[model samples]
Target: MRLLASSLLLLCLSAYSEGTVISKEPGESIHLTCSSEECPTYSNEYHYLYLYYTIDEEAEVVFSNIKSERFSPRGKYESRTKLDIHNRTITLSNLTASDTGIYKCVYKKSSTEKITCSVYAVFITEKTPCSTVSPAVEPSPVLMYIIFVCIISVLAMWILMLLILPKVQQRFIKRRAMHAHQSSADNVYEIMRREEGAQVAAPIGLV
Candidate 1:
């Protein structure tokens, strides 16, 4: 049993030895490189670079060079996937847990057995030691300036609104009261005119 397990482990390690291994956090972007001149894979004279993702030996092809003669690539990967045949590279952004798996890069001259080059790709999301991780990037001065300007604008607007809004509201209320009083006076004057007209016409009416 121990011998079998040891052999299996070694086999698994050997299975992933062909190409580069990358590790990244979720939602991060990654760029993968494939060389046509690279050893063993030789990978030369290919028209397109196809990326396959899987857990088993066989993988689900996720992205391909659309402009390739033999293949136009699949539709679902168009949003966050990109491939370059000239540079022999692939880039994927905004990765998720679903993306964590074995990825393979294949260079295809055509769909035929005449030429197909493949290399294994391994990725891990498990927490790596700090030494392996890239250093945290510092905020740029332009970004800091923009943030500072935004904060200042917000605080200035807030203070101006706080100081001026109440005075404007008070003035509005006074104008409304004045208009109401004018309306009431107009109504009273209309009634008085009516009463005076009635008294002058009848002379028998007491107002």
Candidate 2:
């Protein structure tokens, strides 16, 4: 029995010591949780629950269960503080040094008058280094393949035109010369035939 009790006490200590120590800049937000399986449920009504914080040994109210649709967050909050009553947590946005301290959650079970509490400690630092992330992606092979095919097709067309155009032009010039020579030879033969006919018909006896 004593051993069991010792183990339980150690577990509780571990749970208390394992809380987050938020260290963030003034412009950043700090989240603190008072979460445990044994944590109490939030009150549906304003009369049964209260949340507080202790700063410089002075207790300051943080939230009270209220009828106006949300936690009645208090004192320097002014939209800078957020409370999650159901989760037993608080988030302080746009934090300043004055916002650092111990925070608590208090829930009262009305029928039996039972009270449950959870606490968390917060610490704020002056600054931290900036962080950035860049994603890496593999270049697609399809674009490379398309570019390769286009370059080869253009080169092949250029080579074909360079090698074949001069040959085609030379063949055309030779055909034109052959046609001109044949026409000149036909004209000379017609002139000869006409002179022979005229001579035979006119003066055979005198010659």
- Each model's lDDT: 0.56, 0.56
Candidate 1 — worst ten consecutive residues by lDDT sum? Answer: 1-10
Clashing pairs in 1: none
Tens digit of per-residue lDDT, candidate 2, span 39-147: 5544333245555665335565565553343665667775777776555567778877555555665655565664545665554434423494334333235323333
lDDT of 1 by residue, 5-117 (tens): 32333334334445545656677878766554541243345545566775434554554443542333344445776655556566778776446445666655677733334
